[model samples]
Target: MRKINKYILILAAGVCFTGCTKFDDDINTNPNKPAKVSGTQLIANSEMYLPGIANNAYGSLYPQYLANTTYIDDARYTTVNFNFYSLYYGPLMNLESVINSKTLDGNEGPVENQVAVAKILKAYFFWHLTDRWGDLPYSQALKGSENLNPAYDKQEQIYDNLFLLLDEANATLTNSTGAIKNDIVYGGASLSWKKFANTIHMLMALRLSKVNENKAKTEFNKALNAGIIDNNAANFVYKHLAEETNENYWYTSYTRQGRNWYALSKPLVDLMQGTADPRLATYADKNAKGNYVGLAYGLSDAVKVEEYSLLGSNLRKQTSPVYLVTYAQALFAKAEAAKAGWIPGGDAAAETNYKQAIEASVRQWNNNDVTGLDNFLTQPEVAYTAAEGTRKIATQRWVHLFLNGYESWSEWRRTGFPVLAPAPNNNNKQIPRREGYPTQERLNNTNNYNQAVSSFPYGGSDNLDARVWWDNPNK
Candidate 1:
């Protein structure tokens, strides 16, 4: 029931600490950045970072949804060590501040509600970071003035703690107190927060199916039993505004800056166009020739941008919604879990959820219009078959997650469905399994960084090919 005040958000950004790896060791040394900020301000600042992460250029490129028209280095997988300091210092640190704050004024709802929201958000941010780069400084990293150089926690360990954090948040949630302010996502609605936390838990649990099936089953069912995003209205979406300060990322890039660096990747366009996918029109625009033509995925040579389709207006418009977690995601996760026997009813349940998942995805992407959905589902490749259920669910889920590159990339690594090939001229020769640790880690946290790289389960190498704990190719 509350709206974000841009001026307050601007003020929050100005006063908060800007850097962390060592939890911004400079904060204590500098007089300008505040040592402490309000719980409300901290949460607001953390929420502000979600849109940028959701529309991450690197994230989209990794899954081959978008292709580079000019700078092809990222498409070619040239960068090895992608830094995550922005995440840690930005949302992660801000959420941690809210979680640790002893003083709460109830401006953003009840004190307990604030802490619960903070805990869920903290878990979510860490989940995002660990998925990107395994073995992060979880338990030890947030202590300011106490531990400057914290050791990295293994990905498995981080996941375990993340599950617990979500559980704690879900347990503490109470009815919404209408006084909640500066809360952009759900207007501080406690039920919506509960569903979101549980939804996150369910998805994270499914991520472990390849590595630890028993734990995955237990956790997946636990979260499902608790609750999740059951309807489109309850989806975790970041609503972008028309204002320059808070406009959609694509709008800012294409409309304001007039930089059209990316086009729909050939693989994505071909698959969608071939399938008569209803969402394609909403996902991409017709090229100069007035047909939907995708650009080549990782071409080394310069190419004409006009030959390929650009991102759709629905996506690039200033007020376009950026979906983070959605009912479709929950349904697809359910479809996967049903096929895996994590939940009862087996193929029957899997088929039901799979059908609903596709419907939900079509509706969500096409602005709640299911005009051509029935015929689309009856297609041989799209239809749910028990023998081919996992592949079907995985592929559809990947499609549903368009523009959400990091999540899709993680799923592609785990499932190996709708098999994506290495970029033709990729520097690694294979698709990157994980991003290398930031180069700064080698200098600032030398010993710990070395320890993490050495203890890495898959090959013990700090290269892009090293798989994260849950991304077990053997499974």
Candidate 2:
């Protein structure tokens, strides 16, 4: 696809918009930046910002898969700014711009496909935002020349709209023709996009298992019938380039500093060792003694980091693929759904789906030892127990989503599986349920921000201790 820098494009929009005037005949004047761009260019630009949302440090730290060794602020929940607002000005705006441009002038490709993709992406970003901050400016967000302090929409409302957007994307994709230009995610293939939309809807449905069971079952059945990602080939993944500006975020962070700043966490290492998980080698490197050791998370002061295993080479490489949603996640979601009686299948189907999730995870990491995989599936503790089947799926999902912090932490909150311990040195005396809103929003949009914080069902404060709308704490 195209390689336009999203941030640069956003920053230089006014410069690009300046029309050619009296000096139109000058040859020395550069004409590289077009006065206006197509929906294709905007779609391509939006893909480049995925790393900002996916490869950041909060999700990994919250899930206890990776920890900051030198400075424990993030692990202990001291870091206030997770840069939540950058999402609205950056990727979200870019995507909405695509929708606006396409709608106004028609589309270079099929208008339906262009608008559908834009809507799907818009919903995707909104989902990411609302999950992090609870309620947000969803209904009125991305209005370029409209209201400044857009009112925040409730989390339930956002989810409803997201489901509708995904359904619309599915229909438009099936009915339209012409490849989506600059579509880096699925190479312009409409079928892949359709599967992605449906599977994403399936994932969101699973999130509602604790809060809204009836709605969850309804959406789950619809998404399942519509089809979802079922194999490695159809997984929603993206690989960063090897260039200086385009390298993977983890790779860039490590290369600029040292790799020892962050190390594998003790909880994750213990879990892997307890289960004899072969994926440990795939997640972390061996220490000086050639054994996989992990560092304790949330230490107050700087300490020796070389004593523990660093991140694995496969993940640290500039070319590593960042998995957003995967077949493994889909299987585990189904397993849990079946176990909860949301679907027609019973315990047997849950068992099958659970086993498939484990196998798919193993193979996804390139671990192809048949004997090891078979043993892993059949182990007494690893095997699916009738009473503990849901927990089994939840724990495996946490394992498979190793570096994906937000999703891993979300599942743990929803299912209460794996029983992750709270960080020892956290100032709050407990693990944080949701991050605080950005400081900028509090300053600039004080009234709106305060309104959202007050309307929060659990409490009217935007503290880390407050749970999001769907956070079924007792689960």
lDDT scores in order = 0.86, 0.79
The reply for model 1, stretches above 4 Å from the true place, is 1-7, 10-37, 176-179
TM-score leader: 1
Worst 10 residues of 2 by lDDT: 6-15
Residues 125-205, candidate 1: write the lDDT tens digits. 888899989899988997877887899999999999999999898888888565345677887788899999999999999
Task: Give one digit per residue, the lDDT tens place, for model 2 in 1-475.
Answer: 2244322233233333456565554454455544445676677677777766668788888888887878678788876545566778877887788667724324446766777787777777888887888888887888866878888888999999999988878888743566766677876678788888888899898889878889998998899899899898898887677667767888877875555678899988877877878788889998878988888888888767667888887887876888888899999988888888887678998999999988898888864554477767766768898888877788889999988888888878777877877787675556667878888788877899889988896773677778888996665
Error of 1 at 465 (Å): 0.6
Question: Model 2: how far is 84 from its true place, Å?
Answer: 1.9
Which parts of model 2 are misplaced by more than 4 Å? Answer: 1-37, 102-108, 367-371
Among all windows of 10 consecutive residues in model 1, the one with the lowest summed lDDT is 7-16
Residue-level error in angstroms, candidate 1, position 448: 0.3
What shift in Å separates residue 291 of candidate 2 from its native position after superposition?
A: 0.6
At residue 398, candidate 2 shows an lDDT of 90
